[model samples]
Target: MSWHKHLDTSWFRSDYAAAAMPHDENGCVTGNYWLAWPPYITDDKSDPGSLDKILRRRFKTLEAAMAHVDKAWPLGEETT
Candidate 1:
């Protein structure tokens, strides 16, 4: 005989695995599942004259990152 089981596994996993990283020892991020990192710069200068392009992104939550990805297009949208 064969048996099947229905499970609610959605709670166990996420599309972005990195979102599950352990929070700080203080448990701040654990209380609120949002991790904030320092704003990264491409170069040493605050406002560089170099033509080389630089890209930076900040996400308040995983959903925000996914939303940005979904809105991104080949030609780039007016807002992301």
Candidate 2:
């Protein structure tokens, strides 16, 4: 099964942000799942261009990541 089957699209702010999740050759989930704000870029906090102001969190599973995003940002919350 594809890793994308695990995702809840409603939790994502946009497609660009959702693309942050890592995938293997078969397009199945590989590593950890992530939740982040707009203009989604690298998960590397050390990345010089990364937006520190935006909220970012990593989780072992997509469910955990979605929960974190819901708790931290919540539905109907305005994002940049």
Candidate 3:
């Protein structure tokens, strides 16, 4: 399998992916799932090129991790 599973991008950035879960020394999925994504970006008329996008999420199961992704990404049904 590839290292990353690419997904759609937001207006700010392109080339985004959930990244495959970390693997053990034996090359197996770990018990925990994790992801890092951008936070909400609010635009200000003064500075048109500024953003605060920092978020980290951890999940006990893959389902939970994907649920988080689903909530943030409701579009692109074909990939879903």
Best by TM-score: 2
Global lDDT of each model?
A: 0.28, 0.46, 0.39
Ranking according to TM-score, highest score first? 2, 3, 1
Deviation from native of the Cα of residue 72 in model 3, angstroms: 0.9
Candidate 2 lDDT: 0.46
10 residues in a row with least lDDT, candidate 2: 1-10
Model 2, position 42: C-alpha lDDT score: 51
- Give lDDT tens digits, candidate 1, residues 1-80: 11112221111112121122224565433433322211222344443211131123445565553334334321122311
Evaluate residue 54 in candidate 2 and report its C-alpha lDDT on the 0 to 100 scale: 40
Residue-by-residue lDDT tens digits, candidate 3, 23-55: 567666554554433223335423211232222
lDDT, candidate 2, 1-80, per-residue tens: 11233354323443333324655677675655554444334556765225663434455555666554455545555543
lDDT of prediction 3: 0.39
Model 2: residues with Cα > 4 Å off, grouped in runs: 1-20, 24-56
- The C-alpha RMSD in Å for every predicted model, in order, reads 12.3, 7.0, 9.9
Number of clashing pairs per prediction, in order: 0, 0, 0
Tell me the lDDT of model 1 at 79.
Answer: 19
Where is model 1 more than 4 Å wrong at Cα?
A: 1-55, 74-80
